[model samples]
Target: MSNDLIQVLQNLGRPQVLVLGDLILDRYIWGDAERVSQEAPVILLQADRSETRLGGAANVAQLLRGLEAGVSLAGVTGDDLDGRELRSELEALDVNCDAVLVDDTRPTTVKERFIGRAQHRHPHQMLRVDREQRTALDAQRSETLLQTVLPLIEKHQVVLISDYAKGVCTPEIVQQIITHARQVGVPVIVDPRPGEDYSLYHGATAVTPNRLETTRATGINVQSSDDAFAAGRQLCEELDLKNAFVTLDSDGIAVVQANGDAELLPTRRREVYDITGAGDMVLATIGVAMADGVSLADTARLANIAGGLEVEQIGVVPITRDQMLGDLLTGPRKTYQKVCDLDELAQHVSARRQLKQKIVLTNGCFDLLHVGHVHYLQQAADEGDCLIVAVNSDASIRRLDKAPDRPLFPQQERATMLAALDAVDYVLVFDEETPHALLDRLRPDLLVKGGTYRRDEIVGWELVESYGGDVKPLSVIPGVSTTQIVERLRGQTILKRPAVSQAHAPERKAG
Candidate 1:
C-alpha cells in the first residue's frame, strides 16, 4: 500500500484544472496579547504583522498549482483593491485568472482573522470578521459568468467548484457547469457549501462535503463512518453524483460510489493547528488525481492524506507533491521501518530533498550502541530535518580488522539498535569500506561524523563537498570507543566468536 501510494504521488503528471466558485481574500492580523484592554473587557492585541492570502476557490487553485497542476481560476470578485491584490497573488503563482470577473457593485469577499500569541506560544485565533455579500448574483451577471466559463471547461480535463455560498455559485451556474463538463467528458468536483438543497451541485462527478455539511444535506447527523457512508450514499443518489467524499474530521474520509460501493479512507492523525483550508486541499488533490484518471479509492486516499497534511499547518499552506511523497515514504514511527536498503534509502532521500528538507548523514560500524553513539546521533539530527545513519556490514567490519574478534553484535542487530533511537530518521548498512557509494547516490545536504578528525579527514568529505554539500565534525565522548568496551568485556571472561579469515574477504573497510 505504501509503495502504491508513493508511486501515485511520484507520477502525478501536471494536468490542466479549471477552478470556479467564490473567490475570497483571507487577511490575518498577527500580534501578542500581553494585557487586557482598558476600553473593553476583551484581551488587548498589539498588531505587529498582517498578511493576505487567497481563500475559497482561489485557495483551491493555488493548491493545485502547488501540486504542479496547471490551474485556471474563474470566479467573481469586486472591482476593488482587494480583488486586484488577490489576482496579483494568483498570477504570482502562475494561475491563469483571465476568466476572473469583476463587479463594481459589491466589495471583495474578505475574511479577517486576528491571531494572538501569549508567552511565545503558538498563535490562536482571537476573532474573525467577514466582509462579503451573500446576495445572489443578478441574472445578467450570472449568465455572463456562465457564458464565460462554460466555453473554457472543454479546454481543461477537470473542473473544481469551491462554493463558500458567497453569491458566485448560483443554482443556474452550478448546474450548467456540471452538465457542460459532463457533455465534454470532463469530470467536475464540487466542495459544496452547507445548504439544505444540494441540487445546485447535481450531476457532478463528485462532491466533497465536511461532516456537518453532509449531515445538513442528508439529515443523517453523521457521527461515525457508518453514518458518513449513509450520508455520502444519499448525496450520490439524490444529487446524481458519481461519488460523494464525506470528510469526517479526524476519522478520515468516507467515499460512496453511485454503484453502492463504499469505504472509509483513513488518515494519519495529525496535530491539527488550524483547519482553515483543509477542505480546499482535499478538493484540489482529488481534482488533480481525477484529471489524470486515477481510481476513486486512490483519489480519496490521496485527498485524505492531503487534508491531514493541511491541518497540521497553522493556516492555508498548500500541500506539495513532494510533501505527500515524503509522508508516504516515511510512514509510521516504527523502529524496524526506519531500516532500509540502499535503493529504498535513495528514494526516501530524494523525496525529502524535493521537499527542501536537509539530509544529515553519518557512517559508522555501530557494533555496540552506547550513550556516546546516541549523543552523536542526536547532534547529527539537529543538523538537518532528517538524519541518515549508515552502518557498516558485518563483512565490512570483519575486513576492517579492528581486532582478532570484532563486531560483537551482528549487522542487523546493530542497525535495529540505531533505528530505535529517536534521533535517527533512517538506517542503512553498507558493504563497502567507506560510504562513498552511498554518499554519491544520496548526495546528502550535510555529511556528519563524530570524531576528533578534521572536516577534510572525514570519509567522503571531499565527495560530499564537491556537490555543494557541507561536512561537519562532532565531539565524541572520551573513552567511549567500542574497542575499549570489547576489551573490558573480554577481561570479564566474555566468550568471543571465531573470526572469519581474510582469504574470502571482499575488501578492507573502516568505521
Candidate 2:
C-alpha cells in the first residue's frame, strides 16, 4: 500500500458508520482477592476501582469512532442507570447517540464483571452478572429506531448490526435495516447471536460468527478446520450471505464466500490477557476498512492483527491508529532492540556506519505508521549500508498530529523499537517539523521515500542532493499500509471478509 493510500485511510475522517442493534453497558469491578469470606466459601475481595464502558451495538459505534470514523448508533437502551452510563460513554467517544431510543419496557443490557488480581499470576474473573430482556422489541420502539437510523444509513457507506441476543436485534428491525442498506448500495456487516435463525440476516453483506456460534447456527461440529469450512459454507448458502467469516479462537479465521472459494487466515502469536470485546474490535475495523475502499483479503489480514492487539490487553480497550501502524512497521521485521537514550542510539548508528554502511536517513512524525510507511522504511533500509531512522519528538508529533491523544507510542519508545531492527542501525530523535536541520547534521550517504515524486518531494531531499548524497525511489508495498491496519485493527472486516476452508486451515500450536 502506498503512503498515499494510508493517508487516504487516515484522512477518511468521519465516514459515517451506522450501528443498529442491542445497546448495552459493560461495567468492570477491579479488586484483589485476599482471603476467604467468614460466612461463605467465596474469596474475600478488596475493591480498587470501577469502570463503565459502551457495550453491544453501542460498543460497535465506539470502535468506529476510535478509528476516526463518524459514527451514529441506532439501538434501544432502557431508561435506567446502565442506559445513562452507556450514553455517557458513547458521547465521550464522540459517537452520536441521538438515535439511541430510550425504551421503558426492558432493562438496559448490563454485564458486570468482577476481576480479582494478585501479585504475579493472571487476573481471574469471579463472576459475570448480566441484566437483560431477550424478548422482541415492541412495534412502537422498532418503528422509532428505524425512523431515526434509516436516513443516517443513506448517508453512510457501511452499516453494522451488533446483536447480543438482547431483543433489540429483532427480526423486523434487522430485516428492515438490511433491506434498506442494500437498497442504498450500502453494505451491512453483522456480528450475529448464536441459535438465532439466520433468516434475520438474509441479505447482509457478511456475518461474523465465532466458532461456537457458527457451529450452533449450522449444526456443524467445529472441532477442526475442515468442520469450520463446511459449516461456514452451509451457513452462507443457507442464509444467502455474501460471505461468512467464522472466527476460530487462537487458530485464526476461516472465510467462506458465496462462490465456494474459502480462505483460512492463521492467528498471530500472543499472550492473551482478556478476550472481552474482541469481536467488537474486529467488526468495527473491518467495517471501516471496507468503507474506506480496502480489499477483502487485506482487510482480513489487518483485522487479525487488530484482534491480536486487543486480546493482549484487559477489558474493552480501543486500539489506536498509531499503535496499529507500529505493529505494521514491526510485523515484517524481526530484529528488536531496547535503547534507553538518543546518545546510545546514535553510537549504535555510528558503529554500523563505520563498517562502510551506506546510511539511509529519513524522518517523520510517524504518528500513525501504515503499510506505506513500512514499505517506505523497508525500501529505504534496502538502499543504504544501515538505515538511520529519525523520529519527531512528542511535541513535534503533536504539532503534526494535532490530536492530543495521537502518537500512542512516545518518541523514545518509537525510536527504541525502530533501532532494535536489523534493518535500522540508529534512531535520532528531533523536535523539528522538518528533518532538514537533522539531515544537515547527520549527512547521511543516501535518502529515500516511497512516492512517485522526485527527491524534491521530501522536505530535506534538496539538502541531501546538494551534499552529494543519493536520493532514490522505493517501490510502494501494495495492499499493506498503516491506515488500513488501523481500520482493520479497530474491528472492520466486511469488505475483505476472509474465505473459509478446511483445505487451507491454519496451523495449530500446542499450548
Candidate 2 yields a Cα-based lDDT of 0.74
- Tell me the tens digit of each residue's lDDT in model 2 across 1-511: 3222334334544567888888878888888888889999998778888988877888778777778888888888888887887888888888888788898888999899999987524678888999888898888888888788888888888999998888888888889888988898999999998784788899899998998888788888898888888987887788888887788878887878898888887766888898888999889888887787776665666677678888998888888665665554344433344322455544444444444556787766554555576667877877765677777788776666443665678877777667655566556777777777767766788877654344555567778889788877667565554434544776976356433221011100000
- What are the clashing pairs of model 1? none
Indicate which candidate wins on lDDT.
Answer: 1
How many angstroms is residue 83 displaced in model 1 relative to the true structure, after the best TM-score fit?
3.9
What ranges in model 1 sit over 4 Å off?
Answer: 1-7, 31-40, 79-85, 117-122, 295-298, 312-315, 319-332, 355-358, 382-385, 394-407, 431-436, 445-475, 492-511
Question: Model 1: number of clashes?
Answer: 0
Q: Which stretches of candidate 2 lie over 4 Å from their true place?
A: 1-14, 332-511
The 10-residue segment with the lowest total lDDT in model 2: 502-511
- TM for candidate 2 is 0.67
Q: Compute each candidate's TM-score over C-alphas.
A: 0.84, 0.67
* lDDT of model 1, residue 66: 93
